[model samples]
Target chain A: MNNKVPNNRAWLLVLPMLVLVAFSAIIPLMTVVNYSVQDVLGPNARFFTGTEWFESMLNDSALQAAFLRQISFSLIILAIQIPLGIGIALIMPKRGWQASAVLILITLPLLIPWNVVGSIWQIFTRGDIGLMGWGLRELGVDYNITRNAGDAWVTIVLMDVWHWTPLVAMLCYSGLRSIPEAYYQAARIDRASKWAVFRYIQLPKLTNVLVIAVLLRFMHSFMIYAEPFVLTGGGPGSATTFLSQSLTTMAVGQQDLGPSAAFSLIYFLVILLVSWVFYTTIMHMQKDKHPHGGA
Target chain B: MSYQLENTQRGEKYTTIFSKVTPAQRRNRNARSRWRANCLLGLYLILMILPIYWLINMSLQTNSEILGSMTLWPQNLTFDNYIGIFTNSSWYMGYVNSMLYVAMNMLITICVALPAAYAFSRFTFIGDKHLFFWLLTNLMAPPAVFLLPYFQLYYSVGLFDTHIAVALAHCLFNIPLAIWILEGFMSSVPKEIDETAYIDGYSFPRFFVKIFIPMIRSGIGVTLFFLFMFSWVELLLARTLTATNAQPIGMIMTRTSTASGIDWGTLAAAGVLTIIPGILVVYFVRNHIAKGFALGRT
Candidate 1:
């Protein structure tokens, strides 16, 4: 509950940000919208296409497959990363050199570019010279990401886990640190079990950060590219192709402006709808606990 | 000890009587769990470092050595890969461009976001909630969706391939986050401070700079860290926006492949180099890192 005051002059403060963001977001979004409705044949030659692009895009079996694949990937990463990150955070040292070392080292994967993360995994999973790939082959597991769709999916998920789980851990660690030491002592004196302590004390304290972590992870994973693109190039089949690759292939690669623009609109709408649901649900949960009037 | 003192001060007689015998047993359990915690953390950290270790291993070897066989360590260790990056303008300038734009984006984002964040935290204005949500829609908007429009938008203004163009385009994403984080930190500041400053005859701008800003410096630090992260790590937009002059290091690494083959060693070396700036940024803000990540309304 912020208990914020009402002041119309505050709009003056927000005006600059609005202008800058609108310049970047609104103008381009309008361009996409324009393209979506018109069949752009050449620089000046165009025809009104109505809802044909949207109709076709909706009906297209490939786009539906990509949409389903996108949803599954997002769900899988969130399921794996959230709990794993929380576990890592709970066990992390609370203070000193070890803490700083762990914090920095944990962030190494996040610092690398998405494409390089892709490249790193690409090389590391190679059967010939790569460590994990060679090691797997040596163990006779038959791990070939380039030729196997299942292997490609597994590697992409692993790569994402490596790249992003640190973010969740960092968020949870911060949440945990904010807790007062007195709570732990009180729990200890009561002879609370470890699981009870976590369930009662840590989880409630971690709610805010966990919300942020989940929303961020969900959005980022839903829009994931570059890594999977470089690692398996959407691989052995179109099996690994997610929404972004499909859109990029349509929008930029094939230069099909009308349908790609329509796809972009629908894709943006799906994300907006999902996040709206999540945001409202979270807000409702928080409201029940604190019961305040303002944000 | 302080907790024990507080317990005794509260006249917690039953707790004190029972807790005496449990201390030794509890301490033993604590130590054992601590040991377990270390083992778990160590194993996780090693897995985290495995790919990085392999990258460093290859970066120190020649291309031929990398391709010839798999080795845990370099056989004929060399610095040619690193040397190539330093000696060449094309290679090194990519880093310069990336740092320049990242810094510029961070500066712009924080400046605009601070006032807006203060506004969001302190005052409810017209369409503020709707405005904030709309901005986040940009955050959720896929960069791939904006790819073509961005290229043309910049091109039309003759800002194409400029660092500022990349910086501005990045604002579409970073500003929303900056505002979100700063608003959280700013709201933690009580309304009484603003009123008290006004009572003392402090001007709005002066009070904000002298008092409000410093109070939320940790938030600002974390905001900078995240802004740098998103800007630096984003390739799809950065790569699309720049051609040659303002090419980011990520763009360079992907483009490093020659006709003969990809320069595996050089690419690995460049990847290693990219991680350095991030580490340095993090080190400067390490002490504030934990306090900083509490970036949402409670």
Candidate 2:
């Protein structure tokens, strides 16, 4: 969409956001870039080590493991959440008091603090006291996150699915609601099967929101820190040590500024690249669907 | 005449069979599907609420009772954990500090994003597309990356451990989100409205405040919700930027685990209390959430 009047005065409107973002985003980012290249020896002493940290960070086996773990975690989350969210959205009540009640109930998890989410799961999954833990124990299953890496990984993933799937469901619910009634009516007249209706009508209409949900879930899962940090502390032998946790350990815990800075850039680049691919691919798909540039 | 009567009777028999079988079968199918939908949702709801219910249950019980027993309901119900939080300055102050910073972040993000989103929706400016993408990149940039820099920068500027520092730091992501959401809502409003208001002698600020803002009130609400949620829940930046004076409840909750052991009851109480504010917010905006979700890009 374009306006006939060619005016640049609109920059005045966007100036505050630019300045605020620059202060919060660009300056700090530049600081990271600066630290990535130079070895911070002391409070005042530093030496230029051009790409040395980057080279070593790239070769660090632990960091490589973390990168792979991060990718797998994100992929798993997306795979599970996207379908589950759509399923819930499909079954969700369309209107009336039930709809409102369900919406409020479902969104409760999304609003809770991240650390608190971990804390809830932490206690909930404790074999000695919590309901799930005790129930599993009664069933003769030993479920302990602290002692078992598999348990810890499953607990972390489950915690995330519980926390974030509502977001995708909510987005899909909105997208589903926006579909014109006429489409469904037309399908009914044609005697379209339930799956056919969903595949052709609902899913196609949900493409926009699905794109948003996928990208949002991907970015969020990639940057996940607090929940896993609080829940497992990237523990049980580093089975759940994702990218952010690794960066946090280096930058905050160990104070390894140069290497952590390099790690941060790499992490940022990975997210940016993936998000860009998602954005372009989805946008191209939309363009192809509408040859006349109609939204 | 006998042959004609037999043919009509045969037609009637076929009609009866069709009517008898189809409607009952359809009703049964509908009933069965509805049952299935209810069961699926019912199971999901249980899964969703069980942890929360467990938290609440633990909050109402003594530490020993929680650890020693696995009964469904609290064996010995008590409010001591909650009472402890309300009475303690450190505990209660965590809530206050979190609320203060979250509110400030919401205010700052909306104030800055409104005009910027307007620019993006209304006019094509130099580097507009690039700048928009750049802003969004900040949204995707992990908060972990900024923790070190934010700590050093805020300490240097004497804003460390202040609510303002955390609020400002949260702007890194919230502002971009606010702009994106507000931009989506604003673009749906026709450009002709702005021109008509201006032609009627409404100044820019007057028009924006009186007309445009109300039109996008739901957008603002959604932006506010997102900003509030992110700031309230964000621990890394908030934790890094603050210490005692401005410690958020989230960070404070982590202090429960020490050399001794975890304080199950008190931690549960605090966790339950943390969810209350968000619940209240959702309740107020419950009606707008679906609409807001549709309007807001993300």
Candidate 3:
């Protein structure tokens, strides 16, 4: 390594970033901490309440329900997407013009704006004018996502799958494509079955990309707000109301900044804890298989 | 080389290959596999296109027609809905405001992330690793959690209700991701290049702008595109930060269903328009994302 004496050179490089981040991220976070312990009665009236807000937020049942709902939703989404994404990737054509066309079609949904995703689904599921609603009716299946909680759950889950599975699939495709042709040739020369080839070679190579996909999808699905908000309005009696919606309603609708701030902090901590567990466990499993650095 | 070619030809000629042994069976298996693959592909394509098809179908129908029918296609297609959104200022303002903040946010994210990412990738400074991880915490924190403080801070600073407020708020998330993606890319450049630049008497800024940036153009383009997409469609902070002057299409889409009932047609038309810019951007950058994801490490 070239030892340029650490002469504050890197600091100079990162100075502008730190300044921008301080204004937008650090300052605002400190402000949140300040608000978390204080009472906001009016613009001119403010008083410190210490941890009272945290104490109150801990006992709030609505917040608890929202937390549970969001966790379970994230779990379900990951369970569906990871496996389904792999299956789609497996069957996809590996070369030529058809693969390019297929890639575009698969990626089309990922490009749509989040709110428009919600809007499109909202109209698509409406019983009055929606094709899905109309098709289900013609098929003699009883369906009303707007009013029924079960239907609402199905709709949101399917919507998320439709939107995110492509991301997983694309990541997996890249991972698969990166495997050396020698590995495939060796497997074929050994008369290895398709399942054996995939199990021994393809799966191990895909581990890193899959890990990143799972982490990204987990975090995003946990914090999802706009899609469910636009679709159900967190309604059908809070069946679709996840954590972000609860935080929003508390802060904006009820003007309960004290509880909302505490709730938010707790939510952040929970995500951090869970993601740490996920990352660490994946590393442990990986190490058990390969004593040396796998990559 | 000639000896290797002769060895391969002799080996292949002696090997027992079965191209002619099971033609009928192979043809039957191929047909079956083709049919199975077609079914799966068809189903997936339908799943992907159904929602978009429905949105377009509804956009072409009137409110009365929508409420009256349970049909796949609109009985009478109309242009009134498209007309209403185009003619209405409130509807079009969403496009204008979203475009403005998205541009500003992109500019800020790039300017900041570029050098910060460069530092993280090219140099190991005090607490650099820890600081990088700390920055990622912003990624984990939901926009909803930060709403109260951001609103209060922006309000106190006299930045509320302006495009800058939303753009700055979005920098919270976008900056972290930009740094992460950019750093991954920057680290892949060989260290020898920097020494070469130094030997040529180029300063850090000159080296970065004139040489390094050009080398990592694809990575920078991908990061910029991703940031633009994230900020453009983000709703929670975008809504909380701006009310009257800088509201985005996400907020406008929500307010479409007010006391007057849901403007189904206009919402659909607007929804279709909202997706066009993102689609166009993705079309140009489609080849970059897959490769970019694993630039420095896979």
Candidate 4:
């Protein structure tokens, strides 16, 4: 992890990434910043608005509600998917034909385009035609994603879990595989129970991958747009409208560039803060623990 | 007396060994656990595949059949929906455009990310960590936030409504991810390899292309996979950037649903077709995906 070389010439190698990322990220980001502080009356008519847009966005009740909903939705999915993924990975066949078969099959959901995922769910959950919706109706559960906010929320969460849990499972499976056989052999010699083995061996080894999974899922879920947009149109009274949807509405739909730009900065900041916290905490955890004694 | 005591202790040990589960019991336990694992996996697989199955089932049926009855399987299965997509210009062109931009984005992301990832993995430099984190900040920035700006930016630059615009736009996220994933794989390779290549009198580019690239080939595969998947699946930016000529399949699907009432059969067909390319890619890179994912440290 340590490098003795102090050469700044390495920047040459990184220049392409910087240029590409800047073209895609930095310039647009700067544009957002520029828009956030100015009132764009027309192409030629503009006024410096200062922090007014930021203050107004902070005061907007709908945006605040969307923010809250986004947080809760992210928390719920991470809670469900992390453990479920780990469990699936734990039970997944370690080797042979079944492993490869399961790997390919389970990864199917991940490869589907985001809109297709939503579309697939959209059809799958239609009360008149789709299986899930029809089945729920036949069972007299009174389910409808279009009309019921609860149903919409549940459907979105379910769709996300179905779509993304495989990612976490795959990460954990590889992490599990990377553990040397000697650890398991040692656990067997000690007559360790299943839970004990998981706690002391598997869980510890999976810490790194789990951290990545949690952070990735959290960030991705926080910024979720297309699937929910295609599936619910951020409706059932905006019950499933998350941060990204709200931002899209302000920025693209209404063209409220100034406020949306401010909102965008705030949104970016929240993700950065959370990811930094998650990263630091996990790194700290790893630092405190001694390396396990095995290859 | 001593001999008798030793004999009794050996007998106790024998009894303890005998008290352990017989071979039949062990086999039963193994079977029970295996059965449990299979049941869990089977149930999960069904849950995973059922919606997809329903989608495919709807794709095979006519609109009337899909709406009129709650059939578990298609009753009057037809290939009309599939035929519709192939025959329609907009429908099939959507796929072509989507693939074009996605492929372009993958190429761009890997080309830029490879050397940058190598730099981050190998060398200490001025503001490296800050620069690295800054690049990643783009990953967390919601595309919705940049939709208006990107639209304006690309349009003003006269790149709007082109596949290149979408490809470049996708780079905001994919480049960061590629760098992150590739750096993880690169760092895992010992530093000695780079030094060894240098000592062999190979130039930096040659060593990089010939020696280093092949070493992290799986990493590259994984990076390509992530880049392709993200670029292909991403709709918000892709939709915002292109109106018609470069419109992605996702946009086409959304437009169809809203332009008319929901055309379940055609939509289902489009959805099914969208999944095929991904399935083929996953099949080829099945070996690398699991490992690639693990190597993509936070």
Candidate 5:
């Protein structure tokens, strides 16, 4: 968008990132690729299994279910967080000591370590000791995450919303702030209604930050593990055993490296594929961005 | 882009030209809307703080008090949990190790990502788009998937069980994020800054260090804040990479369970301590972050 100049020599600036990232990313990735195609019984024992592990993992019903659950969870999160975040951002105090205070208060939930977030929620939701749990029961609603799948699902979703909505809000808030005052002044001169100004000016301007927000929330929710692992331990049954939880069980708990590695590649591909779709579709909606038109 | 925005503005001009509102009426409506917005925001902040308040309550209470009926406030308030962490080596050392690696990761990520971001924002080099997308895929790569591979890779390199090992592993993710956010911020700065600086007879590195970096200081602050957050909260790689010597405070919180069963009181106290560092970091960058949030200038 900046009319970015074409210059291969610019790679010099990118070299440090390339080297550091390659050392950390490429090596581990190759190892995963190597493991995905073979069975290693021990240090020296290896059997080249070809795509057998990938075949089995793709056909596996449990992995299939976890994949479906991951999709639904991500959708539900986006559906709630995106619009709610925009509303909060729109309402956020523009500039003052008030803005600073609200920003810090809103960010508190995001700061806690994931597992500690789990622990805090764990004690905070007990019927005997937790405020929410006790207050619910005292008001005549039966609730227990350890016993009910529905309750477990609700708690996880609620906890996630509590922890993550601030991120969405913060992203949208920043986007809102970036709009120059002249645009609003022009709207006022035209006698534009608030809704007209929002629809015509603010929402279109928000597209870039919204893209980042949506993608991040999707990716982070997809990789979620610690909070739920602690909160429900994959629940009353396997009700809330998400993709990461499943993968960890297979890899660490049961030590099924071949299938797990194959599964990992598939998992990575799904995220990449979905993200690519999302990125393209959102970018496509604003076709004016590419003045050169489709090649 | 300008043509399209103007076109939209023109379209909207026809839809509401007849509506005439007095200035006083507009002010009245603003005050009313502002009140409603305040109400919603206030309610949200209260809900957000509830769980945190509960955690603080548990931290201040004695063991017996925690297990007893839910009290709004800790009746039998005690500071034993806090004292235990301060006096003990294992507990406090966890904080030390966590802080060490997180600080290292922040420094490494920022130093590496800044120039890369400048390049991405300013140029269309060969494979630039593909390279940018590939780096982001690192962020999408599940840390769970990388656990075994990371441990084996770090261990085999003989960098295992050291703070540097954890710091480097985190760079695999943090550097990509820093680059992405920094690109957004850098692109917002007008190109004239670069052209003018170059024309002033400044060498590339001197211009970058002297003028360009200062202009994007807010972006750098936000990037540092994020690096601190992700590195501090992440336990899987940190745990897998370091066993004893470099174990973080998060690991200690997980290990608090003993023969008497998990020490809820002590665990809560440690959780509270972990949050303090984040608060300090946020406070330091509060204003910079506010400016950094407004990313799309052009």
Candidate 6:
């Protein structure tokens, strides 16, 4: 550990990456910033409009509604997927080929493209042709994701869970696997009940993984586009129209690039800020417990 | 030599407290447990397989069969749908284009991420931790928020429809992930190796390429596979960034429902085909998938 190398060399290595990233990332960000402050009449026509788009985006009722709906959807998805994922992980076989088989099966859904997931469900949930719709009708449920707002909400939430819970379960499974056998043996010797073992040992050990799972699920679900776009098209009276859908509808469909760009920057900042808070808080917790910054 | 342990205690009326379990009864109990386990596992397997079975079944059936028949299994198994996709015009190109960009993105991500991760892992540079976390913020940011900027930016740069455009845009997320995964692996490596190389007059670039990279080869492989898979399956940005010449399979699936009613047959076929590369990558990296979820390992 007697290394005394100058750290300035580190920047040299990171410089190319930074430059490339800046070209694609930072420069575009600045362009968006520029556009948000101005207006584009056509390809060759433009005019400066300071804070106009930002003010409008702030007061836009549609954007507000979209934000609220997106927040609620994200919360609902997190509520359902986290517990369901943990339950599924807990019930998974402890060891052997059966465990491997279950892992592989669970991973299959995750490997499919998001649009394909939507298409599969879209076809599978059709009343006349899709199995879910047909079966629900036969069972007297009268389900139509396209017609009913509540149904659309349920369908979107369910689809999100189906697609994402595996990620949570996978993280939890790895966390569980890393727990030493000695811990389980100790619990057994202490005559800990199964519930007690889970509550006291397993849950505590799963904190970091679950924190990561929650943050990841929140970010991805909040940003979701293709699946919901395909499945609902932000329809049923805009019930499933989340923030991303709203932005797309404005920016691309309606060609309101100014407001959309402003909204997007704000949206990006919210996620960045929230993620930063979560990350720093987790690090602080780790430092408090480990006293060595978890290194 | 095994002792039977039961949760229940015998009543006081039981005369023989230490009664030996009969071999037949023990065999019956063992058989019952095994049967129970088998039944539970079999049921679990069925539930897991049914939806996938339905997907594949739908993919194989003709449009009429999918819409007209409620049969769980295809009545007449046909490869026409699958063939319909590849033989049709401009359809198969989606797969080729997606593969090309995904590979390019992975290559670019690894090259950028490896050195950045090495610097973050091995050297305590100024603003290192802050920069690392800043990169992570990019990783966590939603792609939708950046779609407009990405499009305009790429368009202005005259790279909007090019393969490199999508690949580089994707690096916004993948580079951060690659750095994180690689850093995790590199930090585990002892610093003594680098010091020894430095003492031997080996430069940083030479040491990193010839020595350090080989040591973290598995990490690189896993990161590459992950980057490839995520970029391959990603729909929104890829769709936004590329147009005719570089459209991915995801965009092709979207285009299925055009002026006509849904191209259900072709859509199904493309949907099935789109999953092939992801499945192949997952198959290759199945063993190391668990390692990437090492949340508490640090």
The lDDT values for all models are 0.88, 0.86, 0.80, 0.86, 0.85, 0.78
**Per-model DockQ against the true two-chain complex:** 0.59, 0.56, 0.47, 0.56, 0.51, 0.47
**Candidate 2 regions off by >4 Å?**
A1-5, A282-295, B1-28, B295-298
Q: Give per-residue lDDT, candidate 3, residue B200.
A: 98
Give TM-scores of chain A for all candidates: 0.96, 0.95, 0.91, 0.95, 0.93, 0.94
Segments in model 1 whose C-alpha atoms lie over 4 Å from true places: B1-15, B19-22, B296-298
With a 3 Å backbone cut-off (N, CA, C), the pairs that clash in candidate 5 are none
Candidate 6 residues B130-218, lDDT tens each? 78787888788677777888887789879988899989999888888788778777877888888899999999779988998998777
lDDT of 3 by residue, A1-295 (tens): 1232344578887888778877877777776777789898988998999999888888878777887888899999999999988888877777776777787778778777787898888888776667777678778889887689999999999999999999898888878888887786666456466677788988988887888789889999999998998888887999999998888888888988766777788888888887777656655764566574321
State in Å the error of residue B46, model 4: 0.3
Candidate 6 segments whose C-alpha is farther than 4 A from its true place: A1-6, A43-45, A293-295, B1-49, B196-203, B295-298
Q: Give the best candidate by lDDT.
A: 1
Cα deviation at A287, candidate 2, in Å, is: 4.8
Cα distance off (Å), candidate 5, residue A220:
0.6
Could you give candidate 6's per-residue lDDT for residues A1-295 as a string of tens digits?
Answer: 1242447768987877787777667876787788788789898898888888989999998889988998898999999989877877766665677776677777777778888888888877888777677888999997999899888888888778778888898888877777776776666445455677788888988887888888888898888888888898889888888888888888888888788888888888888888988788777766676664342
If both were scored by DockQ, which would come out higher, candidate 2 or candidate 5? 2
Q: What does candidate 5's lDDT look like per residue over A31-61, in tens digits?
A: 8899999998998998999999999999999
- Writing each residue's lDDT as its tens digit, candidate 2 over A262-290 gives 99998899888987787677657646765
Sliding window of 10 residues with minimal summed lDDT for model 2 chain A: A286-295
Clashing pairs in 2: none
TM-score of only chain B in every candidate structure: 0.92, 0.90, 0.87, 0.91, 0.88, 0.85
1 or 4: which has the higher lDDT? 1
For B68-155, candidate 3 gives per-residue lDDT tens digits of 7665688898989888888989989988999999999999889988998878766777877567766777777788888888888899
Q: Which of candidates 4 and 6 is the stronger one according to TM-score?
A: 4
Question: For model 4, how does the per-residue alpha-carbon lDDT over B1-298 read when each residue is reduced to its tens digit?
Answer: 1121111111232223323544455555667777888999999999999999998999999999987878888899799999999999988999999999999999988888899988888888899868877876788878888888898899999999999999999999999899888988887788898899899999999999999999989889988988888888888899899988999988887655565477888889999999999999888888888888886542
User: TM-score of every model?
Assistant: 0.96, 0.94, 0.90, 0.94, 0.93, 0.90
Q: Choose 1 or 4, whichever is better by DockQ.
A: 1
